[model samples]
Target: MSTAYVLVEQNNGQLDHVTAELITAARVLGEVTAVVVGEPGTGQGLAAELGALGASVVVAAESPSVTGRLVLPEVDALHILAAHNPGPIVLSANLGGNEIAGRLAARLASGVLCDVVGINADRTADQSIFGDTIQVSAAVGGASPIYTLRAGAVAGEPVAAAGTLQTLELPAATAKDVTVVSATPAERGDRPELPQAKVVIAGGRGVGSAENFKTVLEPLADVLGAAVGATRDAVDLGYYPGEYQIGQTGVTVSPDVYIGFGISGAIQHTSGMQTAKKVIVVNNDEDAPIFDIADLGVVGDLFDVAPALLEEINKRK
Candidate 1:
């Protein structure tokens, strides 16, 4: 039987949503072998969650020095886990997990695929292209296949399982000379963050002003159950939160539908959102760069148009 390794993410022992999805994705391939790498707080429920969802084994790396701050130390134990279980490794596509996935691929001399939405029973990825307009199933090449699963892209089904939980202590990680300091998470809006949004509505300089964004842009997003995003210009002008910017320097998103409200399409901005399945642009300038990639274009005053659009959406629902 093929064995799939699912890396469980923990934040002070709280299980991440991605963990459940990874377990669900593994079910399509074969039996799951879950692994957790970090400090042993009394509350890491990832292992039990994996077990409940049919993980055949759970390997935890507990070392005095192997803190969750770095990937090299975690990669060390991961190599050992893969050797014993020997199969594709799956992880979340978040910053920390993405880094580890890349590092592990380099160390193992393996093929790595990132931001996967789905998986097949034969251990292939259901990859997307052209802004999620196409779905293609692909397998990893090289010695071993490694994949990073994106959050909110996959749905999971739970299955009961009995599994072995092994705790392995490793050599203390060499503390990176980097100084430790207090960490504080950035404050985000109650509105869904862009990465986790199903539909994203973005604004640009075309929207007119920063004040207009809340009155016109935000209400529409709320109607559609969507998150708000912005082009680089919009972010710079304080029309949208910096975290809400989508581009090369910003987060990559693959939402079901992306509605560009008055955003003049910069190639950099399009590069980030081009992965969205359906793109709709609204700009008064008919020749705005955004229209070139837009599946639907509306040339009009957004102040007049957005209210009507929100009304239409609410009526449909």
Candidate 2:
């Protein structure tokens, strides 16, 4: 079987949930070779878990440059690996992953497929395009087609493998690379991360104000243990932080239940949450487009509906 390189996403020594999904997807193509690029000892720590997830080998490319510099180190590391054991390269389709895939593809002069949902036996990929309204099959012309898969595109199934560790020497950094000056971690609240959350409560411009997001939507979310999300308009209006924005340009979430308040159901926002199993929307506007896709649509003010929902849920608890 051909070797498929899967980039392992990690932060502060903890593996991201997407890494397992990448491994599972790569297994459909060939043997999985998980690649970890980070500070020294990062890969060593994650090898066992990667192996349990079906990675046949773990390539740990550790260096101080990885922590001090930006995306260039990753691009360099993957480029070097592709030079030797070239195959399908898989990565998450998030901001950093897309950038790395694009740069690496340019460096390797290979074709790249982004936002891919499935990999066929013939090596073609299935893509949801045009706000996910269209499904297309894509194939790369050259060897080692780089793919940036959407999160939740594949469910991970564990099939144990050797997970043999292989250390690679990263290429020396050049002047072209950007240098990091300082790093400050974002303050994380108790709520689960938006992308990984099983339940999501989102708001839009109809949410009225940031105060409303705090007092109204958040209370309901807290009761349901759902992650808080916002439309681009809400974020732009300063109702919520940009990181909480859910849209085509923002985070893509596939949750078991997605409840929206005051959203107009713009295609950009709907595309992000389209994979959700159940969608419940509340909007006073009777003709809101979001209602078109909602499993349960409530034509009522969110301020009234949200607090009532919160009270009922709390009463149940």
- Using lDDT as the measure, the top candidate is 2
Cα TM-score per model: 0.74, 0.96
| Candidate 1, poorest ten consecutive residues by summed lDDT | 173-182
lDDT of 1 at 122: 67
| Candidates' C-alpha lDDT | 0.76, 0.90
Q: What TM-score number comes out for model 1?
A: 0.74
lDDT of 2 by residue, 1-317 (tens): 89899999999889888888888888988999999999889999999999999999999998877888888878887888888778889999988999999998888889999989887767899998898889999899667789998887787788999999999888878899888889998899999999889999999999999999999988888889999999999999999999998878788888999999999999989989988999999999999999899999999989899988988887898
| Residue 107 displacement in candidate 1 (angstroms) | 3.2
Q: How does model 1 fare in lDDT?
A: 0.76
What's the CA error at residue 49 for candidate 1, in Å?
Answer: 3.3
Which pairs, if any, clash in model 1?
Answer: 131-274, 131-275, 265-290
lDDT of 1 by residue, 63-160 (tens): 54444346765677777877665688888877877888888898788888887878777667887565555678888775557888877566556786
Q: How accurate is candidate 2 locally (lDDT)?
A: 0.90
lDDT of 2 at 49: 91
